[model samples]
Target: MYRIAFGTSGWRGILCEDFTFENVKVVTQAIADHVTAIGERDKGLIVAYDTRFMGERFAKETARVLAGSGIKAYFCKRDTPTPVVSFEILRRGAAGAINFTASHNPPEYNGIKFSPSWGGPALPETTGDIERRANEMLGEVCYRELALDEAARSGLLEEIDPRRTYLAELEKKVDFAAIAGLGTVAVNALYGTGRGYLDEPLTAHKVSVRTMNMHRDPYFGGFPPEPSEKYIQDFINLVKGDPAIRLGIATDGDADRFGIIDEDGTFIEPNYIIALLLDYLVRVRKMTGAVARSVATSHLVDAVARKHGIEVIETPVGFKYIGELISQDRIIIGGEESAGLTIKGHVPEKDGILACFLVAEMVAREGMSVKRLLERLYGEVGTFVTKRENITLSPELEAGYAAKQHQAPGEFAGLKVRETVTVDGSKFILEDGSWLLFRKSGTEPVVRLYGEASSAERLAAVMAAGKAFILG
Candidate 1:
């Protein structure tokens, strides 16, 4: 039997391989046990899934396990976004939620994510307990499942659709009026659950919206359902060819990560978007609090916070750390370079739907395009460019890194390392204020190299030097 493991997000594995129906039942039973131990079985659990292959089947199976365990299951009637699940968990005062989604992973993969009653991703302590329980129950038929009809009859299962309620709450958080004045906008759901969560709201507000890949497609138009630059070329082309469109927005499979295209067809990186939103929230919206960002994010966020005289909390790469700060109401906004963010007063989970709509409002209120606003931001707080590359590691190299015997040089790309941070990985901060981070993937035999510098040319040099150091 495969030892069930959870990563920074959740437990993800290839379908029919490690993530089989039997494994899902085991994990669900473990979650049920955890919830019962906390005395929350009476409070019930929310169940949701994305638009992946057999997503509904997995979610129903999870509900069956919960029902058989004598826990109420507030099951979603359709595929839902991750943030929506988080919101529903808080709204219903449920014990927690189980989401069947691999996020942006390829179609062949599927996984389960558990969010606590606090409406954020489960932290290490919580996930560790669940993981231990799951592995112990593996290879044994330690689960009991009830039929859907029997579960419903016994009041252990109730179907629900939380979209309208979620969108109603969002009306207060986003300035739809400002977006309505911004002429036409384009949305690319990337064949995910973003259609009703993102584009529908704009259309309801009478904003002219052009949508692509809005319908559900398990294949995701033949690529992974990630809203990155390389995968969203069609959306970029649509924005560039159409002179009437003001902005182009896209979301990943779970609608938790975002991709943006400027009016001129330029793909604005998520690092810059996070910094821009932080600046806007502090200066324009008058929100006050510390800003939270992942260590892998750009230093430009630090520059903005410094300019505004606000504190900056830098956490490791996972959004859950940032979400912890959000849950405590300690930060005005928490974001990561991977296009995940959630603000204070919102569910303590990444909401790409909110992020996109807020950007539309930003453009409307500023009376400028996203590109122009970015220029204004650069004018205020210098300029920085960031890049990331992945390197596959050989067995020997992986062993060397795991042993901590292979150390990086004191200088790289002609810059002396001023300091090193071993928070999540090995980060070398250079004298020139540039930085490079080398971190290993938790699920794969690869290392990710992230760099940020004052210019694109300098960023390239830093990345090249980082590659050489890792390979050699």
Candidate 2:
């Protein structure tokens, strides 16, 4: 039997092979047990899904399972974004949320993301308990399911649409008036739950918005519903062909990760976007607080923080750690290199809709394309180049990787290793301000090699040296 394990985000598996109805029940029951044990079951939980295959069916089944456990289920009426589910959990003061989404994963995959009462992704200890409970119940009849009608009759189920409330919340955090002044903004939802969540707010604010992939398609236009450069070529082409479109914004399957294209149709890296947004939020918005970023993220953010005289909090490679600081109002913004981000006074989860709108507002008010703004930032703070690669290891290398990671090298690509950081992985900070990180994927049999330097050539050299170190 396949073990039901929760990774950095959640527990994901192939739709029919491992993420079957029975497995979903087992996981849901495990979550129910965890909630009950924590004494939070009385407050109830939010059950939501993204626009994936059989999404609603899975959500309904989840709600039935919650109801059968004699726990209240605040069921979302339709497919909803991950951040919206987090918003609803805090808005209603509920126990937590069970979000059925695989985020940016491919079509054949689905996942269960559990958030506790703190309105962030569940921590490792909590997920570990749930995993232990789920594994124990794998072969047993783990869950009791109630009919939807019976669940409603017993006052255990309540259907909700979080769009309006979530949008209203964004309206408060983002300056829609500034974005409305822009000539045109192009958006691509990539045929996921972000369709209305990303576009509707713009329309309501009287912004001239052009959108694509707004319809529901389980196949996601034959590509994964990720908004990254490789997965969103059509949107890139559309923006490139149109001069009127000043900015292109896209959101992944669950609207928790953002992708940005400049007026020149250049896909801005998330590392740079985070740094630019951090600068904008502090300099223009006059927001004052420390900033948080994952260790894998570019040091450009740190440069910006130093320029603004704010401290930087470096965390492990998970939004949940950053979310913890956000929940406590300890940081003005928190982001990761993987396109996940959240701000203060918002849901303690990544909100791509908020990030997109904030970018629009910054562009409109600054009167510059994203590229120009990036260039300006580079001139002010020193330039930084970053890259990440997923490298598959041979069986022999895979077996020895754990031990190798512990032995920090003295030099890489001729640069002296100044320090080693083990926040999330083995990261060697070189003498010249460049860094390299090697992290094994929790869910896949691959290692993520991340490198950053002051120049592209240096970044390439650093990455090559990292690869060589792994291979040797």
Candidate 3:
């Protein structure tokens, strides 16, 4: 009887809770209903799931519900990334794609993300429509079971191989030869969906590629599968333990977010990666195009783009905005602070595999370590460090706190707040150039605080002042 609400990407919840088998069936029926109403029922639906709990069963239920509703459904044969399954939708020109992946959330969670026929994420307007349809069908799904033999004969159910199409797209967009030139690169995938995707590309490079933690254990080792600094600190330590491993690569669950550990074993932030890639693509590769990012992303990219006389487009927060910009021919590369990214001629979804190879290619072409590349990038622009912290608060308390931040803070750490932005959250930019942005996490019961400054001390101060505001 639970009405579904779409989060950042799609509907997600704790497995066996709001994400029960019953709810999935209802959601599938809603999707099928929407497609049928829009006159695309014959276009069919594609379904896939990750390695989360009961993911296979969830996908099967989704397909069964869709097929029961007289909508053709082609489900994935095995575990797959959201991006990979999304690729299959476009490859087969299906009506839509439904992927059972919570996408970097804690192991206790599982969810679905839908892709439209364009193969990009279902845009906000369409997602809103789906939500309406799903809520209407809530508790009304009494799915009819179709025998496998009958379903196959009806030509409404099939199993698909989801990898080949996405891999082919990767080969076209990424410069593989550049990455191959790196003599030795260590790849430690953060136990997410990027496991096999990284190997084939690197193996063809003939470079010494070493990988770890590729197993798709659904629990994610008792931690969230996010590719944040803390989540991938193991890879950071691994790189620090060995000087020969020049670059470390990782991906979040579902293989959309990317993590980069420098040669010095420092976890470089995604904002920095965005700026550096912008510089490399436009300045070095002579790729004449603009860069785009969410407003929460570092200003370093804006700084870099201005220096090169290129353009930088800023969105509110979601990759959907950035993806739309890419589709509209506004950007050549798009990345967010949270590590979601995409590029021109690529699927509108963030791709960890493509991001990994792009950075590796930059290192090989420049003949510099990620650490050194950052140094040079900083030398040209300026040095910056960013840190983020999450504070748990009840929804009621968070709503009250946000109401106060809407008008902005008067001061922080003896410096007057010169600017305030409510783009995604309340971002108080102090006159000293230190900044703090407080926003509620869309996926969890926590409020994320992001701070950036030129020094560690200032960054700490920013965090402290921001924490006081949030907790107060």
lDDT of 2 by residue, 1-472 (tens): 6899898899999999999999999999999999999998889999999989998888889999999999999988888999999999999999999999999999999999999999999999999999999999998996998998999999999988988988888878988898999978999988888978888888888888889999988889988888889999999999999999999999999999999999989999999988899899898888889999999999999999999999999999889999999999999999999999998899899998889988999999999999999999999999999999999998898989999887757999999999999888889999999999999987667999999999999989999999999988
lDDT of 1 by residue, 1-472 (tens): 5798988889999999899999999999999999999999999999999999999999999999999999999999998999999999999999999999989988899999999999899999999999999999999999989998999999999999999999999999999988999989999999998978888899999999999999999889999999999998999999999999999999999999999999989999999999999999998999999999998999999999999999999899888899889989999999999999999899899999999998999999999999899889899989999998999999988878866524678888999999998878889999999999999998788999999999999989999999988878
lDDT of each: 0.92, 0.92, 0.80
Clashing pairs in 3: none
Off by over 4 Å in 2: none
Mark the 10 consecutive residues where model 1 has the least summed lDDT. Answer: 399-408
Q: Under the 3 Å rule for N, CA and C atoms, how many clashes does model 3 have?
A: 0
| TM-score against truth, every candidate | 0.99, 0.99, 0.93
Backbone clash total for model 2 is 0
- By summed lDDT, the worst window of 10 consecutive residues in model 2 runs over 437-446
Clash totals for all models, in order? 0, 0, 0
Error of 1 at 341 (Å): 0.6
